[model samples]
Target: MKQLLLIIMLFLISVAAYAQKVYSVDYQNQADVKVFVVKYENQADLKVYKVKYENQAGDNNGKWFFTDYSNQAKKKIYFVDYENQADLKIYFVEYENQAGWSKMSKKQLMY
Candidate 1:
């Protein structure tokens, strides 16, 4: 039972570790993920929430922090002018629980 519990814990840890670490890039060409901010929350593929602490960010939960340097970020993202040009369309949610990916296929774009 202990071994099974350990395996389950490990699986959860690995899953949590896979959540994309995001960074804001200066230029679009330098970014790994291109994002667009949608006007309406219903139109967004992902709902984002800015977290107060960096440690709180995880699990497609939209906990984001704007890092000062590019090197400090895990996944460098560029904000695009048009939604059609973006790899992911996001809406900033006021509440943390409201943040999550609406499109499962687009999840890979973050990682």
Candidate 2:
């Protein structure tokens, strides 16, 4: 029972650490990740869905909750004007189910 409880606790902690609670920073230098919004879905590395609540945020799976304050966020991101300048290129999806990393190679950037 102690081992089971420890495993469960570790799982929860890992999930919380990976939560996609993001804040948009005013400057590129202030950001943890530099992102670009792609015009087309095919051009994107990740498809994002903005959640209304922070609890609805995914584990680096593109379901993002935009935090009002930078301190409240798990990741601070800057929206880059050009795709070439971005570390990650994303497309906003209409549905939550559509949110996920398209290019698996770039998945580590979220972590």
Q: Each model's C-alpha lDDT?
A: 0.80, 0.92
Q: Model 1: per-residue lDDT, tens digit, 25-73? A: 8799999889999999888888899877667778666767666677766
Candidate 1 colliding pairs: none
RMSD of each: 3.2, 2.4
Looking at model 2, residue 3 earns an lDDT score of: 100
TM-score of 1: 0.80
Clashes of 1: 0
Count of backbone collisions within predicted model 2:
0
Q: What are the per-residue Cα lDDT tens digits for candidate 2 across 1-111?
A: 999999999998876764798999999999999999999999999999999987788888999999999988888999999989999999999999999999999988877
How does each model score on TM-score? Answer: 0.80, 0.88
Q: Best TM-score goes to which candidate?
A: 2
- How many clashing residue pairs appear in each of the predictions shown? 0, 0
